[model samples]
Target: MSSPRRRADLFLDPADDPREGGPSLGDERATLTEFLRYQRLTLELKCSGLDAVALARRSVEPSTMSLLGLVRHMADVERGWFRRVMAGQDAPPYYRTDTDPDGDFDGAVPDPAVVADAWEVWRAECAFADRFVAGAPSLDVTGDDRGELTSLREVLVHMIEEYARHNGHADLLRERIDGRIGQ
Candidate 1:
């Protein structure tokens, strides 16, 4: 039997380059979409070619900043913001965190199946967010709750910022894992 594929391979699909055949950064739709796309691409680039252990490896002491953790965290963020906050839906978090707030990272392990599940969930959440945003009204759209008014533009910008912050962490983690750099 062929040896089992690495866990990180499940999350990192370098075959799908986010920058492939896309408009130049200066082109329209390059404002929010481009930044978000680049952030996602950077995350995947940071994760590529790592084994399960490497993906889940914690380089810094007392910090569980693994690529796997980032995947799980992003999944939760997507669901929280787009599904719950934006749509006003009540849903439980993607990962359990009653005992430890850092359960997302703490629970991540060097397992191929677990990695696969994380990627699947993250991709699904991304798709859901995309669909919602595509059909969503103007950025000035307001929720039923008057206090929750926010433009879709603001949410998209916030999402990009979120990815930017985590991608920075991913850069360092990936470098520590395999000396790879430069998006």
Candidate 2:
């Protein structure tokens, strides 16, 4: 787990093309946000065109990693990082509680409503995170995390890393759910 912070470094310079991987050539804030968005989009792409069954299929036996579960978990993560930590709010866990921390992944059943709700929550959280970053003053802005101050730059980088890691799981789960592969 990492601390979240508020920062407004999402200014896209007029010269830098936002389409390209912002890491290659862009301002620090734009690059970080772009990369994070890319990873988030990758997760959505991997889950696209799938129904409840496909989304909820536990492709990896002995492990409960499913597309639906990933969406639910990411929704929780986004809410935890952005709403709770960054905004210093007491937002309750979206899917899990302290007693049942794995509820997000465990409760991912093959139901259309469950899938729909997970996607909706995930998208909403992502949008909220974007808006939070957009409204921040600077990447240097700090937030308190368990008594420790953390910078927005660190949170953004950690978010990108988190999505990339989960997207790897999504790749495997997607391939197992359907024969589709590549990118």
Candidate 3:
């Protein structure tokens, strides 16, 4: 009938899944955290074991997307929503600016230093976000998104959506690179 849904080559082992054992049946905050954590781990897994060149390899012509770009982009996203918006910090973007709107993707060169910096920033931002969420009194904590007062609940959901979408992209990108595939 149908060929196997998964390719026999390079799939992630179930035992290595980072999303395993999260509070799937927990309350809203726990659920959101679990989902976000899954997405974050998926991003990391997809990018694992690649050198700077592979990390910066473009997916296709006219598109600047790459695994390295995704890492940098997520760093900015975590910083933006969690620190700047939610915590009202004065932090600016890590990889974007007024002149370079796509700096995250565009600056993803095949340089080990760049890749290392991106990972460092992304991990730090994630840690900060985790702290903010844990210390938050409630998901109802309001943050100014542009001009509207948005709740932490909305931001968490949006972050999950963002990572989910990008992780899909990462899956495709990684597959294109080395035939790796999995959830």
Candidate 4:
């Protein structure tokens, strides 16, 4: 019998992955944005076809890292680096509090409404970040992050790294949930 991971439909063929590196390379901005876009998409792909219960499943005990929690956490991350730090807006965290700093992940319950809300907020924050990056005068534009002046370029690189690391976690989590795995 074929294992679920070997099921053709559960995983995309390697040749068809959008993140597959191409022969041609673009400028720094394009390259960074493209990488970030695919990393974000990978997170979505990892969590695809799962219900709220599956989305919020913490297969790794003592760790609150669920797919749903990742989404909420990324939303807060996007809002912080882009809106609060770069855009100089007073935007607070979407799912964090002083008393509950890990609210994003801890509050990732298996509720349909919570899942939907997390997706909505995450998407909105992503859109905001895209606009902010596109409209920035230069990647060298600096932002004050807790008394440290950081450039947009640094933030972009950091974000890409952050997503890539989390996506690795997502891959393991997805595999635990179902034998599905790829990319």
Higher TM-score: candidate 1 or 2? Answer: 2
Candidate 4 lDDT by residue in tens digits, 1-183: 966744424567778776677334888888888888988999999988999999999967799989999999999999999999998899999899999999999999999999999999999999999999999988999999988999999999999999999999999889888878746
lDDT by residue for model 2 (79-149), tens: 98888888898878789988888999999999999998999999999999999998989998887777888
- Residue pairs with backbone atoms closer than 3 Å in model 1 (clashes): 139-151, 139-152
Give me the overall lDDT of model 2.
Answer: 0.83
Candidate 3: tens digits of C-alpha lDDT, residues 58-102: 999999999999999999999999988998899899899999999
How many residue pairs clash in each candidate at the backbone level?
2, 0, 0, 0
Q: After superposition, how far is residue 126 of candidate 3 from its true place, in Å?
A: 0.3
* Native-structure RMSD, model 4: 3.1
lDDT of 1 by residue, 1-183 (tens): 899954332233457566555556553334666677777777777787777888899869988779999998898888877887778887556775677777678877899887888888889888888877767655656443236676667777889999999988887788778766546
TM-score, structure 3 vs. true: 0.95
- Which candidate should be chosen as best, given TM-score against the real structure? 3
Error of 2 at 109 (Å): 0.7
Off by over 4 Å in 4: 1-10, 15-23
TM-score of each: 0.81, 0.85, 0.95, 0.91
lDDT, candidates in the order shown: 0.76, 0.83, 0.93, 0.91
TM-score-wise, the better of 2 and 4 is 4
Model 3: lDDT equals 0.93
TM-score of 2: 0.85
